[model samples]
Target: MAEPELIKYRSATGRWVLLATVLGTSLAFIDATVVNIALPEIGRGLSAEAAGLQWTVNGYALSLASLILLGGSLGDRFGRKRVFMIGIGWFAVASLLCGLAPNIELLIGARVLQGIGGALLTPGALAILEASFVRDDRARAIGAWSGLGGIGGALGPFLGGWLVEAGSWRYIFLINVPVAAFVLWVAAKHVPESRNPSAARRIDVAGVLTGAVGLGGLTYGFTAWPMRGPGDPVVLISLAVGVVGLVAFVLVERSSPQPMVPLRIFRTVAFAGANLVTLLVYAANGGVFFLVVINLQVVAGFTPLASGIAMLPVTVLMLLLSSRSGALGQRIGPRIPMTAGPLVCAVALVLMSMIGPDASYLTDVLPGVVIFGLGLSLLVAPLTSTALGSLDDAYAGIASGVNNAVARAAGLLSVAILPLAAGLGAGSLTVSDQLHPVYRHALLICAGLMAAGSVIAFFLIPNRLAAHAPADTFCDPCSPPLRPADTVRSAR
Candidate 1:
């Protein structure tokens, strides 16, 4: 098939493409944040313990992280538009299942399915923009995508809070059906088809299986450790299996002719350093996003709507400042912003830890959230650009997928392990007396993680992307790369 003509960013077709991709990707992004706000309501409704709540969040992250690399590869070989539409349809169906689920077991199962659909579409949305837009307009198009998508993320908590208060936690998931249906119609009608002509036909089934099993085992072991103790046979076995599976995954990637994750990309020091920073920073992020809302409601005596609204500032700051930060990184270097941002966030987390029973929102919550927002806005764009910019354009898809997978996996593990590390026992997430101290300890740990990330950035990240980096390489913290590299596309 002939390559479709790349359109100008301001044209009608460009606008439609942007709208479809934004809405589709937002479904996944919003779901990630929104569910955190609804967790308390879901717990009360289902009579679930802390373990069940953690699983509800980690289940989605696990599937998405494990299969995201494969998802990018599939879109490259199949038509991107086709895979994206399929993902929307799949995600919508999974959301329905989650809404109607009668038990915690069914809800967690449905969440895993939703992650599968997220894995399929998240990279495809960015890839479509890279493939569909003219070279001159690509950067502008991506910048707009990032800013617009950030709005969805910013609104997620508030929307989820309102839904939970207005009626049921079920509406948070159910609302996606109509929005997704509209996205599907727009995508099918206006989105053009594109693919990597040289993409590999072989799929790396072994890599995918091992990675999934590895993440699943580790997540289950950690989540169960607090309730069942480290000495429990089940926890021991799960931890053992997790270790073995991850080792096998690495070995498989090293030997496979067409690996799902080409281990060679890590050889680029900048790429490797950027991803390491991502792991540390996002691990802290995962803990904060997961626990802070719960703390506000359970410990601080805030309403659901109030807790959700508290987080709006972080997203708002990112939406407003991210583009300027990206430009600043390009002009000076990523190292300064990358290093300073996390340190700022570390300070913010320390402040957040001070909130307790009867804490005032104005004095206790607003200060930390505003500071955290400023730090995140500074960090995200540079980190994203450096990770992708370090590699050649051909590796864009794979690079984006790897970085995204690291972020998701970091969040998955943090949510599973933070409670145990903080000394919270079974079913203590909603208990104020037990939770207040645990929440304080957990935020301090997250602060340490962010501080460590800053250290990594200061020592490891370069002052600039490599000399050969693409001129049009622009940042999109919300999305990944535009296309797959030649090595990835032709692997056999």
Candidate 2:
């Protein structure tokens, strides 16, 4: 096969493509963090109970977590640029609706719509970047995307706090409109359209349906159970339906010629293991942040802005050191970093679990945040690189989509279940006395999740860096001599 044309790393087109994708996906990343910061404000404004706030957040995650694979599949089937632009437009409209929403019900509905659009665009952004740059430039481009993406996600709380303090939380949604418009313009003009020719033409409609129903049902059932009581018919039926839908989804995928998930990918132990680690680790990460910010505001008397700013330690560390972490992974292999990183994070969570009504930011919170940030900075790049490296390049989009779906699903379940397990419900989330004990328990649970992730990585992830590392490769072992085919492939 002939070589495809390369978009030089220094070219104007490459820069624009990177810019557009960075901005496009940044919208979703920002929303994920900012909404947590805004939750207390959202609760006050909407007169929403704990159950309502959970729905407000979970509604979006549920849709995104469930449909993201389908979204990636759609982009591969159609043109990535076209689908991405459409998603940006859809997101803009949804954000506008959210900013203008008059009631909690309407806001939740708009948030779901926003997630659908986000799912459509987020995977395509990375996919497009992967396809656009030459192999030599791909790693650097992805590094930039990953680093800047973290910055974007981190910016949410700072921005949301300012907006909320300035007298309205609606601006959080309103701000995305102009940003989305800019992304649309840059994408339509600069991004190249690409798709996999070998990709199946058949749409996985059933897969999408079953996945959504299953995830949404479980999230709803778990989140509502505490508020609705043990015998609530709606909760019981939802749980039952969720289980049935999940089973159906698996059966459907097994039989389908063009499965959205392509279960065969899990045949690689590394791929399966990485995703399991992602699920456990990200679940803990998500639940910890959710509980932390709320605790800071409700129990510790920190203002929304102060609580948001409290996380700057983690965000700043990630932005500064993530590239070095990536290089470290490439040097010594991912196993050490992946294993050690989660354990460090577990320690940080343990420290965080000690915070109480009298906790100080400098002594208690900052230490945990700094340690957590350091651990995360080490984990994310290596974790992602290893997961994607486990598969052939042909399946890059699908691999990323699957991993993303896992992360989001982990977050969705964590947010829903953690509070209930911590004994939080309805009107009790805001009461400092009731929430303090629950918060402590929740943090310990989160720490255990992270520790479990570390154990999984230690057991499952191979020490080699390359996707096709030989059977005998050990941690820190030298790269095996390449066969002729590999030589030619590497030259290309």
Candidate 3:
């Protein structure tokens, strides 16, 4: 009787726990995307050139991606609750540091520390949710929470813009402080501690070392190569060392009793292919958003607030479609939307390439937003469903961590590479002023990459959803399917 009562209490508390996780997780996503709208403000305020501003965002993502899996491992080995509290506490502190930092260099450093804190929080947050919620409810909760993160990500720029318009860009980071404080407090009261019961007693130090060094060096080199010159020894050395470290990590994972990244999981085609798709999709997204933000502000001369408002055309649609795509995939299949969405995005990119500075938002940006949002929304729900469903329950934490890391890694890589795709990193100007041409070309590349992803999804994803159709709880409680059916029956 006492145990049942305890279970009921935990379940009640678990709802709030997941809510806190949503806040915490969404904070990271918002900082990454929405903040891009305000980069010009930050750049001007700090007297930073383009590169410095880029680093402020990229550095956080880079650190977060590299360390996330390890963070998950740490949470598993230690207590997830303990790690989570520490992560939240540190994240709040780092946000304050970022808000207060006097110099560009200090701000970037603080952002990196904040990433470290996010890395610790993200996986542990999800793991706790999964542990608390049972299977069907778990899927729904995850979908809803993931959708919430998406909404937060989409809503981020608007929030940042409002803050920038009212206060300094510093307020963007400072704003996170209160949100973080609330989440931390709620999490403290509600979230329970859990650990990997089966984990090896000893830490896999070798694997951790290799993963950090390898991923870090490779990502840095990719970002630096365009500006540093291809022949630069620093670029070559970083790449070479990164390659070696990666190989070493692979070897270590194979031999270790416990591993940071389990090598065997990649052997599954669905798992591996899905993650590959995730990488490519996120990479394109990361790069594309940056291009859009820069083009709007620099080329079009839109204010931070204006740029964010202009973005509502895309994100609102994304929220609408994502909530429903899961059911649509279940009824028919994932393939139709999967193939069509990217193809549409490709079309949008092509249209964007043709638009000049004088192009109207309706004619240029609107069409692209509609297409891109539809395409991306199609991709998100199915990709998430497939990835999670592909694995056994035992690997949930690992799978989520790996998938999240891949997406972040892809975003970071895109940031590094797409800027160079312009082929004018240091050409006639310090940075190309009218990057419309470059933006056009880069967006076209994104379209092409997305087109390729569509093909991969078509070929790789299973034709049918699971026998137990999981509802995307993040969406409307009444799915579209049941609504139409109910209407038809009422006529009888």
Best by TM-score: 2
Cα lDDT of model 3 by residue, 106-159, tens digit: 999999999899888888777665544443344445545666677787777778
lDDT at position 349, candidate 1: 99
Error of 3 at 336 (Å): 5.0
Model 3 scores worst on lDDT over the 10 consecutive residues at: 1-10
Give each prediction's root-mean-square deviation over alpha carbons.
Answer: 6.1, 7.1, 7.5
Residue 423 CA displacement from its true place in model 1, Å: 4.7
lDDT of each: 0.80, 0.78, 0.70
Per-model TM-score on C-alpha atoms: 0.81, 0.84, 0.80
Error of 1 at 485 (Å): 27
Between candidates 1 and 3, the one scoring higher on TM-score is 1
Q: Candidate 1: list runs displaced more than 4 Å.
A: 1-15, 32-62, 97-110, 129-147, 157-171, 189-196, 222-231, 423-434, 467-492
- How many clashes (backbone atoms < 3 Å, residues ≥3 apart in a chain or on different chains) does model 1 have? 4
- RMSD of candidate 1 to true structure, Å: 6.1
Pairs of colliding residues, candidate 1: 394-484, 394-485, 395-485, 397-483
By lDDT, the candidates rank as: 1, 2, 3
Count of clashes in candidate 2: 0
* Model 2 lDDT-worst window of ten: 469-478
Question: Where does candidate 2 stray beyond 4 Å?
Answer: 6-15, 32-58, 100-109, 133-143, 164-170, 229-231, 420-433, 465-492
